[model samples]
Target: MTTREWAGDAETRQVTEVASERELRELIGEPNDRAANKIRSRLHDLDRQWLARSPFCYLATADAEGRCDVSPKGDPAGFTLVLDDATLAIPDRPGNKRLDGFRNILANPQVGLNYVLPGRSDTLRINGRGRILRDAPFFDDMVVKGNRPRLALLVEIDEVFYHCSKAFLRSQLWQPESWQPDAVPSRARIAKGIEAPDIPLEQLEAHYGAGYADRLYG
Candidate 1:
């Protein structure tokens, strides 16, 4: 089929598959349901406290191989620094030498970022075109002691939205007073368990801990 015809055919819905409200909403569930009212247009600016309150985030990217990578980034709330309404910069904190996320960016410029706020019920999701920025852009994010990062990844945001962290609230994510130690695994021990063919996970942990102090903020 021609390109236009193929696109049309894909969008044409069969009338036989009509869905019942109970079946649809029940399947979609409450948390996944659309909000009664939603904001239009992306907010170019970020509220300062959002960055200050966030302790962890996940970076998602897809490479030419069609394999996708999702990596966790964390720090004392505010490791991610927003430069302006149009640009957001993340300090490339050191990790295992794998650099899977960075490598994927070289082959694919698209990225999805989810910034999670600590003890809060809302998170930020952003989709953007990203590029590696150097020199001043990199230096501006430096810490008082760590020096500066070699470079920073600059993301030119296309769209951004806030998600209600209903699940987190239901799970009592931030209620540290009631949290059980067994709920979360110790990073050090968890790292010691994984044994990859190419690189031992324990070795990766050692390298990450050694370099993180110097790479982040510095």
Candidate 2:
């Protein structure tokens, strides 16, 4: 069958697969000049500026067993403190206390961070080793709205780089005109599918709202 005919006939189409690094390289070839040269092992002045203006980041971590998790962290701009060229710190705010990220740090110190700023097409990526600290001087410096974070994640930088804008450009992430209307499922509707179908949704929502306002600070 021709390529188009093979695609059209589902029964004859076994998954087109590349099972090894050699096959992968044959398929995609090598990176060009800019792609091969963009990575940096240490933070630079421009990287610091990008991080300082960012209010949000996604943190990726894995436990000793290699179970992985990614969690969102957000606060006011520059909430993440660049302690030096080789170290950074992020405050831990109060939340549901699942501690998935924190627990992973204890078992496996390696972490990956992607910092994003609104309206900015490029993002900063950092790979590091993390440790949880409660040292008074360091933890006390992260006070927000008169509340100090009980813990802070101190990351020793290993690698840092600026990822290009292809992803955001393809998704039109910063274009309000291309956005769809908010159609988020209700908390109650989500809860019903999980573990608690019998409880009233109103009570769950009210409790969540109150906790959001009252326990937001750490």
Q: TM-score each candidate.
A: 0.66, 0.85
Clash pairs for candidate 1: 146-218, 147-218, 148-218, 149-218
Name the regions of candidate 1 deviating beyond 4 angstroms: 1-41, 44-46, 183-188, 196-218
Task: Give the Cα error of residue 184 in candidate 2, in Å.
Answer: 3.9
Roughly what TM-score does model 1 have, to 2 decimal places? 0.66
For residue 73, model 1's alpha carbon misses the true position, in angstroms, by: 1.9
TM-score of model 2 relative to the true fold? 0.85
RMSD of each: 8.6, 4.6
Candidate 2: worst 10 consecutive residues by lDDT?
Answer: 1-10
Q: In candidate 2, which residue pairs clash?
A: none
Q: How accurate is candidate 1 locally (lDDT)?
A: 0.71
Count of clashing residue pairs in every prediction: 4, 0
**Candidate 2: tens digits of C-alpha lDDT, residues 116-210:** 99998999999999999876576766788987888899999998888889999999999999986457666656776686778888876775555
